[model samples]
Every structure is written in structure tokens, then in C-alpha cells.
Target: MFITSENATPVFKDLTLVMPAVAVGNVGQLAVDLLISTFNLPRVGYLHTDCLIPMAGNNPYATGKDDAGELHTAAEVYTAPELKLAVLQIRAPVVKSKSRRFRQLLLSWIKASGFSRTLVLSSSHAYQRDDQQLQGTPLRYLVTPSLLKTSGDAFKELGWREMEKRAPLCPERLDTGAEEERLYVPGGGITKGLYMDSCTEDVPLAVLLVFCSEGDNVPDAMALVSHLDDWLHLLDNPNREGKWKIPTSWNLLFGSGIPPAIF
Candidate 1:
């Protein structure tokens, strides 16, 4: 269930919610990290449930050594009121059997909060793409009908590629009149399921994802954030002339230090 800190339950009405899928290369989560770090969003609350694998760690957005001891949960919420943006940074994978339940809880919260729209950042395996998907940029986007009506023009203006739809399986069957095109996201963890659920539930949602493989994906995260910056103008200087502030918590990303034995 979603729980807000006593003093952090600021109104989220009409705000945009951004979250990441624990997908291939963890690109989405890393990109979310960049946003949190760059904006220094403050923690608002966390989702408490058995759906996600239990995990905890030092706060990844802490600004000083004194704050380094703060513990962060697997699924935490952060907000930037100035931008009217709320982000859910998920650090662990959902338990397979409880995935559906988690999605339901999430949708419920989204509805109750009255967010105007939501964007999910995710990634898929590059090798799974068809020939056509390989012809252009690796980045792709998907928007529900409602969201398309509102933000479609902006996407077109940005020259963003819309994810391709595939013909439904068992095309041989003719009773259905015609084979409907379906969105397929192989290796995207909960991405496809969540997006489809949002569409069916009439939630105005957009999915922005990149095609990538396992291994070093920091570059992919950077590219994904840049793509988002084009749409949201999160960066003050769009020309890359300005510097972004990195969160001090990132200092412990690999670890505090190497072992003396290794040295």
C-alpha cells in the first residue's frame, strides 16, 4: 500500500508521475537516479508491500556524510514541487507471484492521487527487435489513446519514434475478422503488463523505453534521460553547456573503498 510521511503528503493532483521498470540493464532505474540526483528531490514516502523483493540500503540521494546513514526502501517516492513532478524510484524486482497484486495497488494509488498523467521509463533487449525496429533510433515511446490526444503533437515535434505494434499471435484464425496489432515488449519485465493495464483502466500513461542489452548501461541511462529532457525541459541549459549536480550519495555506488588486501 502507499503511505506518505506525516509531513510529506503534499497534493499530487494533476502532477506527473515518473517511474522505472526493473528491466534489462536496469536502464530505467538508473535514469531515474539521474533525475533524483540532478533535481535533489526529497523523499515523500514509500510503498509498503510484500509484492516487491525485500531490500533496503543507504539513501542514494543523500547530500552529506551526516545523512548517509539514512536507510532507503525498495520502493520510495520523491517529489519536486516546483516541477510538479513525483517520481517512484524502485530499486528491487517485484516477486513473480505478486506482480499482479503490485500493479493493482499501484494503479489504485495513481487513481486515488489524481495524477494528471504518468510516464514509465523502461528498456528492452536489443537483440529481440525485429528488422524494422532496427532501422531507426533505439529509443521508442508508447502512449494510451488519452495521452496521445494530449501529448502526441509534442512527441511528433520531438521526432520521437512510436513503438511498433505486432500482429496478434495465431494469425491463422479468421473468426476474429482481422488480426489486431498488439504491443510486444520482450524482456521488459513488468513494462508491457503495466502499460496494457494502464490503457485498459483508462489511465493517461506514456512509456518511454530504449533498446539495450546487458553489461555497462550507464550510457543507455544517459541517453534515456537526454530523450526525456527533450520532452520535459528538465535541464536549464538544453545545449549541454551547463553542469548538472550529482547527488553525494552516488559516492558509494560501487562501495566506500577498495579492500586493503586487494591493494
Candidate 2:
């Protein structure tokens, strides 16, 4: 599971799982381990965009939306179009800005490869499931629930008052800096930088595996897809006023269809 520089290449027999950071390498090291060790999946390819180009190491964290690095070349050997499916672990909405270009290129390659079944894996916001409200009203702190949950401590370590752990006995949720005026202290705790967090973990893997079974029970796959889409839509729309709800057409997009070939 600890795929160090020594033994980084291995051929998978059935399916190929692709994620953006898995290409740059270090960023999704843990995730790659989970996919390979936990699920026994193989590394087929990766995406390396411009942001990832500069910091490109053997396998660095994903800083861009479209850099395939060695994966582009490895595609033919590792990612065969005839494979059963391709699992793309990209939590949508969170990467909406960068994902557009990334997805475009991925879809293009898929079309070229002629692969029919593709699963776009994503996780919902943790806040949506936990029902946790934003500690303060700040435009910058507005993030998906999954991001917050996955990145539990990074936010606090960054010294953002909004994420600071208040006194356990008398917890006071700090507002986005604008609310700091309420506390007459200067520099009490405020550091600034891009705050990125990913908290959700349940939905996608489960959904993906249901299909990975790849059995004749197509109805089971159909049901799981329906369940997943329903959850995602509910998280996408958080209504503070009314009871949260998923859209009616959650299953319209999924079924037994083959994945888009990205080989």
C-alpha cells in the first residue's frame, strides 16, 4: 500500500481508477493507498493540469486541473478500453472552477478511447449530513460540507478564528473576521491564506463498488446510483428555512451504461 518510489508501477486486471491528485503524486498519496489497498484497485492513469505542472514531482499533490504526467503514456498499457469501467474520484461542486477544464479533457480522452461505462465519484458536504451551521457569516468560509469534514484540523492549524477551537465549556463561534470587532482584542488569532477542506467520505465509494460487483443484478447498480444522486442533490441545495430534500430526478443520470473511455 505504501507505494514508495521503489515499486510504483503495477498492472491492474479489471478496472482502472483515476483521480487528479494521484498523477501529481504526493497530494493524494493516502487516497491512492486507500483505493489500492482497501479496494485492491489498480492505478491506470492520472490528470496533471497547469497548477500541478510547476510543482511536478514524481507524484506530488494535485495543484492543477489537467496534468497527466506519465499517466498519458501509461494509458495504453494500464488503461485498456475494454476494461469493465473507470472510477473518477472527483468530488464535484467543490472543484467546479478547476474541474470544467479538467473534465473537458477527460471526457475528450474518454471519447477517443471508446470506453462506455464511467463513474464520476464525488462526496457530499459533511455539514449537510451533520447539520452543523457555519460558526460565522463569512463569504470566504462558505465551503461544501465534505471539505470541512475531511479537512478537520487544517483550518484550525491555519489560525483562522472562525475555525479555532473555543473553550470547550463555553464555546463561542467566531464570525468571519468582520465579526472580530465584537472582541476588542487585536491579533487574537487571525492568519490568512487559501482555506481548502474536504470532509465527506461515505457515498461515492459505496456507490462505485455496487457497480464494481459487475454482476448480472443490474437492478442493484441502478438502485445504488439512484440513492447516490439523491444524496448529492440534497447536499447541493441546503435550505435553511425548510426541510432539506433531494431532487425528484436523482436517478436520471445513472444505470448500467458503460463508462466513458479515457484510455
| TM-score winner | 1
| Candidate 1 per-residue lDDT over residues 104-170, each given as its tens digit | 8999999999998999999999998887899979999999887888998999899999999877557
* Model 1, runs deviating above 4 Å: 167-180, 237-244, 248-263
lDDT for 205 in candidate 1 is 93
Candidate 2, residue 226: how far the Cα is off, in Å: 17
Model 2 misplacement above 4 A: 1-32, 38-48, 51-98, 129-263
| lDDT score for residue 239 of model 2 | 29
lDDT of all the models against the reference? 0.87, 0.28
Candidate 2: tens digits of C-alpha lDDT, residues 175-257: 44323422111111111101121112111111111111212323332333333334323223242222222222122324545
Clashes of each: 0, 32
lDDT of 1 at 67: 85
Give the Å shift of residue 255 in candidate 1: 6.1
